[model samples]
Target: MTAAQMTSTSAGDGAEVAAKGTTEKRRLEGSLGVPSIVFMVIAAAAPITVIGGNSPIAIGNGPGSGAPLGFLIAGLVMILFSVGFVTMTPYVKEAGAFFSYVATASGARMGVGTAFTALVTYYGIQIGCYGYVGWAIGDLVTAFGGPDIPWPVYSFAAIAAVAVIGYHNIDVSSKFLAVALVCEIGIVCILDVAVFINGGPEGISWHSFDVSHVTDSGFGIAILYALTGFIGFESTAVYRDEAKNPSRTIPLATYAAVLIIGVFYTISTWALVTGAGASKARSVALETVSGNANMMIDMAGQYAGVVVRDIMQVLLVTSIFACVLSFHNIISRYQFTLANKGVLPAALGVAHPKHDAPSRSSILTTVLGALLLLILVVAGLDPLGGVFGYCAAIATCGMMILMLVSSVSVFVFFRRHHEIVGNPVTTTIVPLLASLGLAACLVFILVNFTMVTGGSMAVSVILALIPFLAFAGGFVTAAASPRMRGRFMANVL
Candidate 1:
């Protein structure tokens, strides 16, 4: 089959065609520029505020002051993976995202698996963010004399806001995300700088970067958790059809996003150590920040004055909301794309004729998020532990699997295409090794998921396995459908 006729099957019909030969007009506008791409990356990266603000507290108390080292190790591994990831972007030419890449490399079954896993992970994370937003908003509201609202109310409010924003033009959302991203990064940077200026009680310490600290028993687990903070970095490719000169923009953005997030995290974690004192950092973090992110603002107040602290608090809330907005867009798009490809119901594939956005998909995602919030509120579960924890764990598992599969797809694509063989490091060696490394990390995270979160082994195991099950479901469905099965293999191989 020629590459031109192998495009993805539409919801209405099942047929094999090569992607290269198909002349379907691109529906998405290439309106997103570098600034917009940067905004998307930052919006996706905003969740790190919560992760960084709390992880040290969890680890310092449970695992020790070696938390910073764990972050550094994870950063290094991600950097290695990014080297190959950026290299692979120029080769793949599909808007189906990672599913397209996996299809081209591993055939229809794996492509379906990849797409399903991504959908589960994206929506799970989106729903998960609602709980965090609810908790954060509840704290903010209670401080202002408002009644202590239930988490579901806050979550529902957040979903409503996101739905309104998400059903609009991409440019509008991009601009909104850009502003929120700046505020989030600025607040975090201020905190980091304050910690540095105040200096540690014991003075500067290099122990936070020590290899021994990173190799600790819980260090790998910590690293795995830390790695999730960078989960959305690879999504640069998700905008392939909507990016100007994607061959260049996608690869550069991918690498730049990874490096930026990694450095930001390493520096931020290190600053926290210095700000809180290496010896007492963990204790201070747990006492202050873990239960309430506002504690960080209080610390900033003591060290940098009340004005800065108040400003930071406002920014934190905005950051959390921005993440809610960003993930809503991502999850909705995943649904839209998958539905267009016939994996999901066609209703989800319908783009708003006027806005050109996936209106139904966005509404579905927002509704699901609101529903999850209601369930958690009714159950009286701690939004943090019950909702956020479960969602984060599930999302992490899904993202890790996606990364592993993409890395392997990179290797397979290069091996089969052969045109890129001259650059073995970029095409074959780097991704192959990165895939193996990520696979090991994936196994480690799965085995230790319960210990890392201090949750029940049964709960953690079930949550961690959801993405894999989603993938298996897709594979099964694809195998059972002759049209899908034929189209997948014919185009991919």
Candidate 2:
């Protein structure tokens, strides 16, 4: 080739590389420090919502006394998994959390598969919250002697609000989440103290943690309930690319999220059991099974007074809103990553020049969630019982399986790249241990999904297998198309 022609080609290649490098670099604001990242992940966990919604079942339905142990075990497994997860962070600067990690360890085909699963799961969970949040808003109004609007109306309104929040700089959402998170935890602590002062129904006892109680009738289900509380904790890694000082920020945020949420679950659940009285916990929980979702509200009135109960009820709604918003942001970021990497339509990868957020991806996520909400409304399903219970369970189940895959993949990645150096615990053993814990949880969820959903076995089976199908489908699609595999390898793998 002529020198002039070669010179032009070289210039084009350099500019292309520079533009590629600048894509993620200039799109996200690096302002989300550790504390902000923590709020996002913890909010997604929705501590107040979990305690109010799941604790009664955990205490009464599952291993009665042994339920708290499930949190400890789940937390430990996550902490162990994080050791290897963050260890690999330095190698993958802007790659999507599980998307990149799974790709790097497995292959581009599998990575695309994992990305699809993560995307579907995050999207489903947010939609599930939308169903519940509308019902929550309706209740909030009627309880205050205000008019009760239809839930679908409230659901659409909430989707708009969340889309707006998610379309801005992430720091904006972080600050908002921090406030909601503090209120959620604060009220729980207040009620916890009051329960202690009032001495509970039968007074405090160690019966909540008794091994015999955990191994009782519904042992598998109790552990399932407790472990699901940590569903959003792994989202810490989701913000790695956008986090300030990502290497330091991610590990700290992840460890902190798991530890804080873990302690909160263990202590608050025990207090709840005591508040209801250990011996009477099962009976009280069963009584509430008909209605009265928030036993904390009941406990708040019993110990603190009526005023606290009302406030707690209001915060419960906000707690779920915060959770919905948090997941909205997560889904957008993941979709943006997929799009930019060629795993999805490129339109989703567009970032707002001014806001530095994935504007298009956020809007798409909002629209998709709204569409799901519409389907629920049109089907005339019960918002809380049918939509939230069924969709959320499937989402949570998908995430658990992904975590299981990630734990095992961490070991594979480190083992394959022997040149990659890290402590043995972080590189090898911890990943293996995490894999086992997550696998056990996945097994229980799959086997007992029908029982968990309180629905038809066929529907439960379909929901439970969504993650596996997404993962396998991604791999097969990629394997079938050389072009797709080439792009995944070039961009992400």
Full-model lDDT for every candidate: 0.73, 0.78
After superposing candidate 2 on the true structure, give the runs of residues whose Cα lies further than 4 Å from its correct spot. Answer: 1-26, 491-493
Model 2 alpha-carbon miss at residue 185, Å: 0.6
Which segments of model 1 are wrong by more than 4 Å? Answer: 1-26, 51-54, 58-63, 288-295, 486-493
Model 1, residue 157: distance off in Å is 0.4
Q: Write the per-residue lDDT of candidate 2 for residues 1-493, one digit (tens) a residue.
A: 2222211212222234367775433235556789999999999999998888777777667765566665556666677777777776665555378877888678888788888888878877888889989998998899899997898888899999998999998888999999999998999999888887777878876666665654577766766877777777767777875787776888888889888988898888778778887777776766555575557678788888998899898999899999999999888988877776667886777678788888888998888899888988898888877888888888878888788878788889778877655688888888888888778888888888886777898889888888788888888888898877766655332
Top candidate on TM-score is 2
**Candidate with best lDDT:** 2
* Candidate 2 backbone collisions, by pair: 65-208
**Total clashing pairs for each candidate:** 12, 1
| Candidate 1, poorest ten consecutive residues by summed lDDT | 9-18
